[model samples]
Target: MLSKSISSLAKRVSSGLTPLRSNPEFWLAGTIPWLKTEQLGEKFIYSTTEKISKIALKKTSIKICRPNTLTIAMYGEGKTRGNVSIIKSEMATNQACCNIELDPELADFEYVYYFLKTQYNELRSLSSGVRKNLNSEDIKNFVIRLPQELKDQRKVAAVLSALDAKIDCNNRINAELEAMAKALYDYWFVQFEFPDANGKPYKSSGGKMVYNDMLGREIPQGWVVGALSDWIAKDKTGDWGKDMAEGNYTLSVDCIRGTDINGLNGKGAVAAPTRFILEKNKGKILAPFDLVIEISGGSPTQSTGRLALMTSESIKRFSRPVICSNFCKAISLKNSPYAFNFAYLWKSAYENKVLFGWEGKTSGIKNLLFEAFTTKYVVCMPSQHLAQGFFDFVCPIEDMKQKRLKENDELALLRDWLLPLLMNGQVTVA
Candidate 1:
């Protein structure tokens, strides 16, 4: 194996790829987009809405870095620095992002991407400055070891990329399935157009409607307006010790953060982080169809009271029971059917500000006024038969999403497991 300084091996390496500092005044807004530290870790970033137009690009020393270049975050806080990604297309970047366009004949860009990914901690350690910034020299002087043959580099990259491709494909499938489910929810509940007698669209077909004083709208006759407590069997805020206790390995509470909640649904959650615990608290253990609500942690733009449904796939992924942190509250529904219809209802509530209406902010942390919101906010309760039907229709879709998410988790595991082996020459491709 031979080692080479990244700068010596690469045809181009840049820390300040664009004039972000000197020309901040010219970067008001424009047609051409640029990336920030937040968008750097993904394999491909398609849009950076915060951008400067082509006209603005001409006014400053900024230039569009070409496609296939690797970009790294040189400065940021809390896992922002040292993260890497590839710009699959031509784009401009801010000062915090260092763009490296490699010489194809000398190195494979994908190979370099993976190599840099493995060196995130090392890169962070090399960072200097009051804020621990990774400068142009830091990136240039970095050393990488690899086989002399360029084919070998491509081979290693190909192996990793194949796994990534599979993971990406799985995520796409899950997103599509979720979208389909959401569309169905909107069509049925939001529109009040669920199938009526003789299988006709209810609202459009002139199904009887009565005004509900609480909801301030006309709902299907015989349906009731009720609070969330009607459907909730048991609910409690989670509990955790000062440190994660050690006995047997179990799931991590990180899986249920506020960011994981998108209205009533959760995304990008599969396996839990590895944490050891003495025993599972039976009350805290999560079951399929349960709801985990983010009761704390909020930003000015995003409030508390986000909800995520616990799926069967998640329950099966961990050997021990799944649990949330003190920041979250877990609620078990009276029946499984409520999981489908209620999730959408809660989503509507979130959008309409019903859930966040009672939030309280203190010390920069937002607390969900759970009892206040639950008691005051009303839900459109479908009849028993319609709720059952909605659950039957949406269950399969959620199942499909869960299956795809599980597959992605497995694929990611396979890729991470193989990365070091392939990087160290233990596993080779001809």
Candidate 2:
């Protein structure tokens, strides 16, 4: 085994640059995929949110990296600072990322990526400055121990990669299931192409239509125009209980925060904490089909209205009954049958950027005008029978998606448990 500084094992170590955003030519019709700290949660990245143009590349210090270059964030307030991801295509990054291009002969790229995952806290501690951020020098100077033989290093990486491979497979499956749900919602609601009495697409089969001044579109004759709030039966704000049990704080439950929405939805790992609250708040226990909506805490690039549907299956993932944090609120549809439908409708509105219009700034933090947003956003309401039908169709799909998610959590736990032991030579792959 040999221990060496990361700088010695690499061909180059550097950070990237962000082109001046005010310059229109730097961004218009861009083609090169650009990366940011926001895209670091994944293990392997094939694409990014924004791309850079040729002009920006030529005019600035920004440079695109080749495939397989390891990238890590230089800073974060929470768990992001030391997070790492490997790009699978040509890409450029912002100044906040530290990109490492390792010499293939000396260091196994995947091995180093996995090693760094276990060193998040240690790596973050290396940050220095008023911003408390990491620079390229800190990363290059970091030391790692690996098997002297290249083949041995590959063996360890292969074991860990295989585990992540399974998780990736699950992610692909979950994504497809999510798309299917959205397609069903769009067909039934947006296109009005839901199945008719004769089992044909409703709108296409010439279902009766009426023009409503509010919806500004022709909906089915029986379909009514209703405000979003009309469909909701209850709007209960969440409770943020004490972090530890205290006098009179005896009830124990898992508290989901605004950040845990993605993890609960299976996009990433959710680490919602267990909290102690008064027994009175037990009435707000999250039930199946109830939607947990993020009401606060959004970045400038993101919004505060992310949504997650609680399920009987998802609830089982927690140690106890779950409640959302103060940053979020739960909404129950007028009826359990319409729960899934309304959830889908809210998602459509969010994706259409409607939430952005309804958001307001208070103390520089963006907040959703929950009542105003819900009251003004109009939707062509589905009848109870149709809503029930959609609910029934989605139940099994949610079941399958959650099944894979639970498996992923277990798989990830195993991988994380093995990672450090494998890297430190406490455990061997072969």
Candidate 3:
């Protein structure tokens, strides 16, 4: 039954094509073996930093697809959480390029890309290989259902595309807002610039001033030196004694190694495909709005002690949970109004210190000790009004970010719902 269907589809495709048997380009000019799956980024196309020689490209028969073509990675490693992305660029040396040219009549490229991404897991399950690979034959043999009308395809693509376009716009807005806030921070804090009483620009009176050993420059008058521990609570006693029961509580890592920090959620929210969990460990269950810091294990001097704000939901889901391996989670004090900004500030300073301290070191992962973080430092405690004012100024940007994320999530759901339906003809474009 499958063979007959495939043969019929092949004949139909052949009939639609303008035959050119003699053209050399009609056949693939070259074949290449993918360098490795790990080399591919979340965006399609592996980085040139990991490129192999032209000789290596000839080892495999895979041909590159054009930019914006609908493609899929037939084999998936456990990495990427089963993601599928459209081809965004020309062929790379180490990737199994798509062989099938996209059918403009059958589907919109972006629509097809989203559909395939949604069905990524199903495709992976059908793929055969120790490393998980799907061949071109497998893809061609797979059936796709479509509405006979081009208008229907356009309609379906348009609906989904609008959401994606909105999401992209929100992302841009968020980026701009963040850039604005960072610029403000640099101007006031780093550059020591503030308005004088007469609204004239002055260095010392308008901004908080402080002396810094690191900078060898005197800062604004009101600024003071401090550590994260001063504003946040650090459970340094190392006592998780009673909370270690296996079933009663779960421990989670403060950070997931090899994952992007931007993707991590706090405030007791659980992101899908939770990769890290804690065994029984003695620690307080994290609370909502609590700041969680990755105290250990990132680039040794860089990204160590990175921080995130835990929502209330995350605390409920993973409270009493063991701290996952290779991470430490710290919660900020409830009273600290500036905890979020403080987290960012401390992270920046700590990361800078690490970079300076670990120059030329092979180990990127840094181990954070509780004593150093808790006992040694103080944090600037600006008045609640000031903190609130700062947050108010930036809240719109944060809202834009949240909106973008929500739109992306919705787009993902729609894409997933459409993939198998369109592929199987259950959902037609018309």
Best by lDDT: 2
Taking the tens digit of each residue's C-alpha lDDT, what string does model 1 give over 168-218? Answer: 887787778778888878888888888888899998899999988888899
Residue 57 in candidate 1, Cα distance off native in Å: 1.8
Between prediction 1 and prediction 2, the one with superior TM-score is 2
Q: Model 1, 254: alpha-carbon shift in Å?
A: 10
- Count of clashing pairs, candidate 3: 37
Q: lDDT for each of the candidates?
A: 0.76, 0.88, 0.48
Write out the backbone clash pairs for model 1: 30-53, 31-53
Q: Per-residue lDDT tens digits of candidate 3, residues 73-172?
A: 5444454323445545555423343323465654555555555555565666666766666665666656544445657656766766776566566556
TM-score of each: 0.87, 0.95, 0.62
Better of 1 and 3 by TM-score: 1
Give candidate 1 misplaced runs (Cα > 4 Å): 15-30, 211-213, 242-280, 348-357
Residue 418 CA displacement from its true place in model 3, Å = 4.8
Clashing pairs in 2: none
Residues 177-257, candidate 2: write the lDDT tens digits.
988988998898888898899999998898988899997878988987878889888876799889899988889989999
